[model samples]
Target: MSDGWEDSADAWVASQGEEGDFGRRWVMDAPMLERVRRRPYVRALDVGCGEGRFCRMLAGEGIAAVGIDPTVALIDHARRLDPGGDYRVEAAEAIGFDGGAFDLVISYLSLIDIPDVATAIREMTRVLAPGGTLLIANLAGYNSAADAHGLGWVTLADGRRVHAMDDYLEERTAWIEWRGIRIRNWHRPLGAYMTPLLEQGLTLTHFAEPPAHGGDPARQALYNRAPWFLLMEWQKPRAGSSSGPTGRA
Candidate 1:
């Protein structure tokens, strides 16, 4: 959600009740949390922490977590739901926190929403402490259709369902509007993401286009045909390290 986020905040929050939408609840949560569990982090930050969901999750795991978002309404909701949580209204492109402040930083499904991704990524990397982890869960490039007509299964001429995609390599914005939720999300090729992080000297620790688990059969098939999300773990280089993360996978 972008400039219109205030109008759509309630619906977005409602769509993700206690768990999240299908992608977050069934697909991304387990693996994302698993990656978090792999390393011990004393302090963590959630870059686009909508409603403080992931931040609360990190707190549950005994980590001191802080959440930041550009939407004031969403931050208000987050503070209401999580009274003691640290929820701030801040943009990812320019985090107010001091550099090297967080041991673990996450940008969960918020990368596509930020209009200035390069600056946001830089800020996320800046807040990360040496040897810290930046775990990301993002929509697959194909999912953010340029036309924004929405991407899913469609019956072909032979009556076989296929996911149609026209521009996989194009960087564009998709105005996603549905069921009272309207937000602008960006679509970029893998290079649009990878190159910047690599330039920052961040090491790729783990990457996966993991499948959904223990869900409706039909839904699983749909997700398999064209993955809705992918997870990536990048580690900031320590002062003297020349290699990647200690636990590479």
Candidate 2:
């Protein structure tokens, strides 16, 4: 795969210091991890695995996981930081895996970055085992970076800062460069994200809008300013498919 974004992603993730910090706190909660643990999936895929934080988390629990990202540096960092799990440099729209290859496929906050998100979702469904589960949690809905003034920057070619927020009009690609690294972060309404799943025959099993970490006043203010998080569980509908636990919103 031709990856032009590798080095910047590495530097950006490395800049984050640890596997559990940075902006991921909103998505990687204890309750969410527990939900993943109790699921029936044995084989899994983490799309846009970034530094492979969650992949390593899943591996630590003994579930076999393959983390895929088009950015080579991110994959390399994931390998170096989390040695036990598998990591690959591959595009979300073109994951080089066989059909029905995974019992679960997860895309954390990474979904909105891919330009052809619908195609990626379909590919995820195509490679998912019958009755497999797809878990997506991220900054979506009325809550998005757009509301956070993220729409103003331009991301450059070295993967830093080149495209502006208004550039998202293309529908297939959208990202901004921070410093010099290109970060594909697109913000869309909740329905825009969930509609594809329903069209692809995936049933919504759970939805959540957990209150932001309540301790920090600044965070609480931002949480109130925007919908900071939304978690949704989707399942490939089939007879006898287990209905998972419903979470609070």
Candidate 3:
């Protein structure tokens, strides 16, 4: 499973030979980076920072950013894109940064493939500076991926076919594919997603359910009908303050 992804990461960078700026500038990375412009964070960590798109964006914004990804190819490509900030090939779960090192820690659409996601979240919390924000965007809710794939169906216990969102959530599985690489994207209720953060000594400040992009205005109009992805903002309370969770949005 991991081998295909390791190769896919390299192939992805190779395929982006040019027009890489198109994605880093206009697509996913740019939009999210723009969203955090008003944040007062000075230092940030972009975990699983594949290709360092977000890392470069942060560096451009004057934030001292460090990008870490397990794929060497991605890091190499990132270095070529922007050598200003630090870039390292590392695991999302075993980050070596000292505790309370960054004012912000972000993972853009990278949590789905992480096997021990809870452990990864804990690592992120460990590195987060006091009163820092940890932003995460990932596939959310059951049937979200099926909707993205333009499919609608459910599998009963007896292997019967049913076609409905509710039925699917109750029985079927949903997966996500990025740049032709299919991976298991575990979907959970909004509370289930927030539960781990609470356990990691973080509090959810805000949540977003954005519209999908496909070009069809009518289809896009209905995209927000069901949230396929969630942007969760969590904060770490100040050190020596209180072990209890408390933070302003």
The model with the greatest lDDT is: 1
Assess the local accuracy of residue 183 in candidate 2 as a C-alpha lDDT between 0 and 100: 55
Of the candidates numbered 2 and 3, which has the greater TM-score value?
2
What value of lDDT does candidate 3 attain over all alpha carbons? Answer: 0.68
Q: Rate the local accuracy (lDDT) of all candidates.
A: 0.86, 0.70, 0.68
Can you give the TM-score per candidate against the true fold? Answer: 0.93, 0.77, 0.75
Ranking by TM-score: 1, 2, 3
How would you encode candidate 2's per-residue C-alpha lDDT over 1-249 as one tens digit per residue? 223366477567755556454346543465467678777569999998888888877887778999998877788888898776689999889989998899899987788767678899989988888787898877654444342346333457676732233322233334456555665566665666777777777878888776655446765555555445677888885545543342211
Which parts of model 3 have CA positions greater than 4 angstroms off?
A: 1-3, 14-31, 143-184, 212-219, 243-249
Q: For model 2, what is the error of residue 244's alpha carbon versus the real structure, in angstroms, after optimal superposition? A: 18
Residue 20, candidate 3: how far off, in angstroms?
8.1
Candidate 1: count the clashes: 0
Q: Which candidate would rank higher by TM-score, 1 or 3?
A: 1
**Which has the higher lDDT value, candidate number 2 or candidate number 3?**
2
Worst 10 residues of 2 by lDDT: 162-171
